[model samples]
Target: MDTIIIEGGSTRLKGQVTIEGAKNAVLPLLAATILPQEGKTLLRNVPILSDVFTMNNVVKGLNIALEFNQEKKEILVDATGDILDEAPYEYVSQMRASIVVLGPILARQGHAKVSMPGGCSIGSRPIDLHLKGLELMGAKISQVGGDITATAKKLKGANIYMDFPSVGATQNLMMAATLADGVTVIENAAREPEIVDLAVLLNKMGADVKGAGTETLIITGVERLHGAEHDVVQDRIEAGTFMIAAAMTSGDVLIKDAIWEHNRPLLAKLTEMGVEATEEADGIRIKSDLTKLKPVTVKTLPHPGFPTDMQAQFTALMAVVNGESTMIETVFENRFQHLEEMRRMGLHSEILRDTAIIHGGQDLQGAPVMSTDLRASAALILTGMVAKGQTKVTKLNHLDRGYYQFHEKLKALGAKIERVSEVEHV
Candidate 1:
């Protein structure tokens, strides 16, 4: 087991840190690579994360010729050859995002058999919306032996309305509809920037998609799609985590090339907590001087609101701020598991139905903790940076799924952190 050991107290993180490409965006973009029948797709600025390796292996499992160059952060995919109809249980079982490939495989091969997906234990993330939308688009869905299969001789478009604006469902349906026989309209669709980025790539690949970044998406089917080039969008969740780190330490740091618009909600809340964030031509710079931070209430929602991904990190911030703070998690039911680990580090909190009421201003002492999920891993490390003694955070497999060189980046910013194996740490 790997653990990140942090020596806390009187440490202020400073200096500029570069943000990585969005892990959420790159997975679906890799799935879209299967849709192109000819030419090679070039994706630039791909993040080097464990999940990327899993998704890349998933694409390679489909018989597509793929090359990932980590030095240049680029991926060249030659999907001009024949594609396989099935994504095996070994790959899909490791990452839930691999299920997005089911849509493109069906669009290209007219049949897709994928194993039941698995991921973090944050909550129940059902694929009912994905299956229902595909059924609306004239795809027959069935389950057998832990695999969900979809078959469509020739898919035809229809007006599909989603009960919830699920990002994965929207991406899967958009890719599936891109090669259908007619126009597909998705109402109540996800309006994330990653969705708009996918729409840009699909259009470049001869797809006619409109109204992206809105509730309704109109995609007209094309005979076939060709490979295209695109750059992955910056990750707002990573930027927000570092922003919170800078503010909590009362340090001055700049997040290079971070988009202010993408992190507007977090920036607004940071300002309310008495932190100064300025938008510059280079990137966003955050500065803080308060000895004790102000408490604030937070509610996680879909994009354009406070992101559910950042809720755990902000909760870590709330634990140290003065007065009482409330965190309401409306996205994932079991996301508050990190709070239990935080209790070992001397955090005071009470969990209600979907809300956590944190009584701040308590002295946090460093202790052994475990990461509950991907985002929770970062949150625990952040808490360790301000604790009184040494904090050891384990279950780093979750951290590697999303963040790239996280501890190295923090160390460069003056964080007294080191990653070592369990035996070495002991």
Candidate 2:
């Protein structure tokens, strides 16, 4: 087992850190590779993370020849040859994002059978919206055993509406609508920047998709799609995590290439806590040397709202603030599992249903904590930045699923951290 060991105390994070491409965008783009019938798709700015590897393997398992050049940070996918229809449990079970490939597979091969996917146990992320959207587009879907099989003689477009603006459902349905006949309109679609990134790639691949960064999406079906080159967007969640860490420690850090627009809500929240975030020519520069931070209320919502992903990190910030803060998580249930772990470190917080009342002004002493999910792992590490004594974070595999070189980056910013490996038992 591997753990991130942190010697926590007052530390200043000063320097510029460049972020990798967005993990949320690249996974769906990797799935989008299956839509192209010929030519090679070149993806630029791909993040070097464990989940990306898992999704790449899932793509390759379907007979798509993939070559990843780490130094170049590019993935060359040639899904031009004979494609397979089944995505086995071996690969799909490792990451829930693999469910995305099912839509692309059915769009290209006309039939697909994929094993149920498994990922972070944050909440129940059902694919019913995806299935329902496909069914509206004339695809017959059914659940047999542990697999979902979808088939259509020829998929035709239709008008569909989502109860919630789910990022995964929008990506899957949008990709599936590429080779579909006629036109497909998705109402209440996800307006995340990653969705816009996918739309850019799909359009480059010869699919007519519009209104990507808006509430509605219009995709006109094409006979077939060809490979294209695209650049992935920056990881807003990863950057936001670093931004919060900087603010929590009252440090100065310049996050390079971080899109200010994508992280407006987080920056606004930081500003409310008396943190100074200045938009520079290259990126956003954050400075925080406050003796005390003001408490602020946060409500997690879809894009253009405070993101659910940043809730955990923000809660850590509220732990040592001037007063009590309230946080309501509207996106995922059971996300408060990390709060129980926080209590072990001497933080006080009350959880009622989906809302948490965090009492600040408590001195923190480090303790061993286990990560519950990918974002929870980040939350724990952020808390460790200001905690007294040594903090050891286990279940690093969760952290690795998203952020690339997380410890190395923090270390570069002058944090006392290390990656330790335990002896293997035979």
Candidate 3:
């Protein structure tokens, strides 16, 4: 186990930080590499996060050769030969994104055996949507001993409509549809930029996909896909996390390599709350005055809307604001697990259904907090940033799973934080 210790700093932080590639985009795109048929599929600008490593392990488990260069931050995946079609529970239980292998494996090998995914910090992310979509595409799905076996003699395209716009389900089905017999249509699909990024990569690989960043997607079956190179988009969630940190510390920070278009909704809300934000061609800059921030309401929705991943960080920002702020997490029902931990820090908040009403303007005193999930770990660190004294956050492995160099990045911006290993219990 590991814990993070944060010492309160009264000075306003002023510096520039570079954002990394999108984790959400890179994970699915890595899974899509299973369809490549020629030279190595190269992915550049990859983030150095544990989730990436986990996904890479899952890929390697399938006998796909991969070469990763941490110095250049590039990954070369070779999948031109016969590959294993089974993703065991040992790998899939660590992260939910491991489920993505089902699509590519089924597409390339006509069968896949993947483990049932484990629980996460958020709500129950059922794969019923994914299994249902695959069934519509002529795949027979069954569960035995915590593994899902999907087999298809030949996949034929059909009209499929999602009950909900699930990002994972949409991406999985889209990849599976690429090798179907005929045209496939996905209605009420996810419109995240990550989905569009995958579509772009698939197109470069000779996949006929249209209207990817929209509600309806059209895909025509192709004989096979060839190798292609792609660079992942910047992580909007990381950018948003840094922006919230700047606001909490009354600092001025410039975040480079961030996509302003993908973060328009968050930036707009920050501006409406009186945080000074300017979008430049290179990146976006945020500056916060020492005055109390005005409260604002936020509701997480599908892409081209406010993302649910940022909800926890925004909740941390609301803890010290002037008035009341309400956060409605529409995507995940149990995402407010961090509120209780925040309350331990002397912050006042109440959860009503899926919404959290935060009464700000309290002087938060540092306290021991436990991280329940990846995003909640980020929120705990943000709370530590503005607390009155020293704060210790446990379960840092959750934080490492997503953010790269989290403590180092905060330290570069003048934060007093350090990572210390915990002693094992006999």
All predictions: root-mean-square deviation over Cα?
0.9, 1.4, 1.6
TM-score, each model?
0.99, 0.98, 0.97
Candidate 1, residues 1-426, lDDT tens digits: the string is 899999997778899999999998999999999999889999999999999999999999998999999999999999998779999778899998998999999999999999999999999999999999999989999999999999999889989999989999999999999999899999999988889989999999999999999999999999999999999999988999999999888889999999998899999999998899999998999998746568999998888779999999999888888889999999889999999999999999999989999998799999999999999999999999999999999999999999999999999999999999878857
Off by over 4 Å in 2: 424-426
Between prediction 1 and prediction 2, which has the larger lDDT?
Answer: 1
Instruction: Tell me how many clashing residue pairs each candidate has.
Output: 0, 0, 0
The true-versus-predicted C-alpha distance at residue 419 of model 2, in Å, is 0.7
Model 1: weakest 10-residue lDDT segment is: 288-297
Q: Arrange candidates by lDDT, descending.
A: 1, 2, 3
- Residue 321 accuracy (lDDT) in model 2: 82
lDDT at position 421, candidate 1: 87
The top-ranked prediction according to lDDT is 1
Q: Could you tell me the lDDT of residue 395 within candidate 2? A: 94
Model 3 lDDT per residue over 240-276, tens place:
9999899888999999877888888888888878899
The TM-score obtained by model 2 is 0.98
- Count backbone clashes in candidate 2: 0
lDDT value, candidate 3, whole model: 0.89
